[model samples]
Target: MAIPAQAPPAEEVVADPVPPPDRRRSILARIWGVYAIRRIVYALSVVWLVTTGTFFMIRAMPGDPVEVLAGKLSMSGLTMDVARVRAEQALAWDPNANIFVQYFEYLGNLLRGDFGMVIGLHNTSVLDHIMKYLPWTLFSVGLGVVVAILLGMGVGMIMAYYRNGLFDHIMSAVASTLSAIPNYLGAMALILIGSTWLGLFDFWDMRGRISIGVEPGFTGEFIGDALYHAILPLITYAFTITGGWMLVMKASTTEVLGEDYVTVARARGLKGRRIGMSYVGRNSILPLIPQVALAIGTLVGGAVIVEKILFYPGIGELLIGSITTRDYPVIQGVVLILTCAVIFTNLLVDLLNSWIDPRIRKEGAST
Candidate 1:
């Protein structure tokens, strides 16, 4: 009993231990892991494949591009000798060089954005023409796509919320009917009604950016005129494409709404708006990311039917004219540009999907 006072029960002392160097090394190893390097390499490989494959495919197409240009020039009353000289100079087509050498030169020119002259259009560089018309196509079709997506998502969400109620049934029927109709067919019908019946838009004598009475420059007047001409085509695209989005989104939303988490959210007595925004919208909208990306590509490339029908000075018309004239330079440029656009769009959607669904990213990392 007397000795117990001396030891004070031999209390244990705890130390604040520091992490080992091996643990720190492990964290650093993970931070700069193989998965990150692999992703970067994968992306670069895709870019290389697209660029090289595009070049080869264009080269493999039938008919000499130089000869095509010369033929087009001759049609415009240029002498054969002069046309051949100009074509050779423009394309650098040496009679002495082999096919591989010619392909390499063409690839170099393409990479430099020198697409040569548009065969049918004198004094117009193919690259310049594409850049000039691309904005109009992008602006008009892009607006239409946005409108379609917004309206589609709203109506689809409402229909899904009601399940098999009257709202759902009505939307399903309308969407089905519209989706069954082709976009071009719908465009033609709208054009007939718009021009013949309602007389809202002018059918003929709608040439250039503005009315002939107004002078053309890069002025607000010209832009306003261009936009005035664009409205019908834009509306046509939206009307034709909306049905597809509505049906797809409606089906997706209904599926998402049936998930267990949605039921749990409901049972928890969460506000309807809160539950919808956080759970329903989040899950249902994942598929829309790819659709939106594809729409972006289509928008930028121009609507072939809508632009052709409306006679809009956009890429679709440019492509059409090139095809008719066998303008190889323009055709190759457009195809390459569009192919790159589509690939990039898909890549962007893939990245977005990984962001939205962490499971995808995790799976990728593991691989």
Candidate 2:
């Protein structure tokens, strides 16, 4: 009887059917879900748009390069026809070509690493000009940004810690005033107060990136002289930007101080210093990381005005001269460089943000 019962129970024990894998979705996810790849594509698209716009806009300006050169040559007693011929011959680009044609050519040349030659400057390569001037601007502005960020973050943390006290009130007011001032205005004020009113430093002596006789090297004399000339612009940049940083960090820190983790850390008997730094300060600074890259771009653009004011020989100064002379190649080259700088920096910051915050990477992947 037991054997008969066991024999009756051995019916079909079929397994559940397994669905086929979604190969298409899996492939699409691999291609589009990568955060760095998306950011890079976006950056490249922006660079292309900027390059195109800059190319056309420069050509659309009221005066042409040939006319500008011709006018200058006429001032030197050459006949108008000869001056025009010389201008045409000296230019790396054709003034009479269709703009669309020139644009395509420019793009082709750009792809080949050819930036064309600077007009009215003995046909110097645009890349060479940039190499010569970009470093000074980077040195001055980069140092200033670093100093401003450090000073501002520290002061901001203090302001948040002492919220609404006398020191906070004083600093808030100072920050507001400084932030309201334009960077060029800051440069001017520094010149006025330091040179005109107080006679603290001679404007003439500080007009360039360095003293005339200092050779370029790692030597102390060259370094010291470069710093001396850079001091005014650096100070102007630091103070002008520091105020904004302080205000931002203060707001960020204040918000973080009210966060649950910060509160929990405090309640867990963590020391004030440890809690303030490890929990509050660290979280507060996270939002500012993206801003640092943006600040670099902003500073580079602002350098045009500040460098012009200071007579500092940075790319900004070169850009101004190019614009004034209608040097199309140099103008296009400088603007393209600046645009690339800003776009790529933002891309890098995005990737860095993804690395710093897992949530960002997760969100990016899901998309």
Candidate 3:
């Protein structure tokens, strides 16, 4: 304290405080930082445009919607004159309302998630109908796709690792053949071979989510019946889906095998299995991740066709009914759901990738 009595001079040449250097961020990093918000905005915009376009397109169609509704009635043997059908349509929504006004109202309802009552089903809530069938779709098609992906990816990796070997060649040929066949064609073959000609799974019910009289529940009878009914449709989606995934995975893995890190791993005296798992397999899978995520939506689209053939009680089946009846509300609701599912899934995949990539994460953290 005594030594400090000589105070430090304050009059020494003062220099201006230097600011930290501005670090440059890469384009990818910038994209990552704003990715979530950007994706959401883009998705919403796409939805809006599509919904608006669909609404207008429906309005612009040559036939009157009321007459279309009446046609459905006629099919049911409940004959209705054009006048009465027009009256009914008027009650459905404001038929007389300005198109723009109707659009705004429609938009408002959509924002509130107010999918109106089903016209064809006579006041059956659209939401209730969707909820009823969506589970079946998820259970059957969703599960089938996931199984395909896992099995396909595994088979593909093995094929890639042992490229040109007997097992690989055999699998490749089988995969190519399966992939070349159309999904519906495969379904037909399965139907004909398994059901019509072979009679292998004759005890397995060919159509519907469950037996006609079986009450749905956790009971063994209901579950067993439901599973039995689901098998045919499950086979159609899973095995057909597997071929495409195998081809993709084989290509991706093959590409990754030639990369520098893989060579280094080999040089470091790593076991073949270890190198494959840690280096090649891990990277080879990255390309497939996006496709797998997108498959959720595509699987639903595929189910629409597959379920029609299988007669599964899924939303695809419901969609077919609504389309035939020209139930505008139901049609709109389903389309909206599909669009949302796809776009949102895309957004999720994009954000997830950013989070998964360490480089992106580090850059984002810096920002």
Task: State which candidate has the highest TM-score.
Answer: 2
* Residue lDDT tens for model 3, 217-263: 99999988887888877788787878888988999999999899898
lDDT for model 1, please. 0.75
State the number of backbone clashes in model 2: 0
Which portions of model 1 show Cα errors greater than 4 Å?
1-87, 90-92, 95-97, 112-114, 120-125, 197-200, 205-210, 213-224, 255-290, 299-302, 361-367
Best candidate, lDDT: 2
Tens digits of per-residue lDDT, candidate 2, 1-367, equal 4654444556788775753478667776688778888889899999899888888898788998899999999999999999999999888878788888888999999999999998877858999989999999999999899999999999999999999999999999999998899999999999899899999989998889878778999999999999999998899899899999999999999999999998898889999999987999899998788889888887887789999999999989999999989888889899988888888888878888788787997887776
Of the two candidates 1 and 2, the one with more favorable lDDT, higher being better, is: 2
Model 2 scores a C-alpha lDDT of: 0.89
The TM-score of predicted model 2 comes to: 0.84
Writing each residue's lDDT as its tens digit, candidate 1 over 1-367 gives: 5655465576688774966899889987676554444455666577567656755665566766567778878998999889988877765346358867866777788768677667646688888889987777787878788888998888998888997999889988998887677656776887799888998777675534457666767899887877677776677778877888888888999999999999999999999999999999988987787779777775565466567877777887887877665566687677767766666676676777676777876787665
Off by over 4 Å in 2: 1-33, 74-77, 255-271, 277-283, 358-367
Q: On a 0 to 1 TM-score scale, where does candidate 3 land against the true structure?
A: 0.77
Least lDDT summed over 10 consecutive residues: which range in candidate 3?
19-28
Clashes of each: 0, 0, 0
Sorted by TM-score (best first), the order is 2, 3, 1
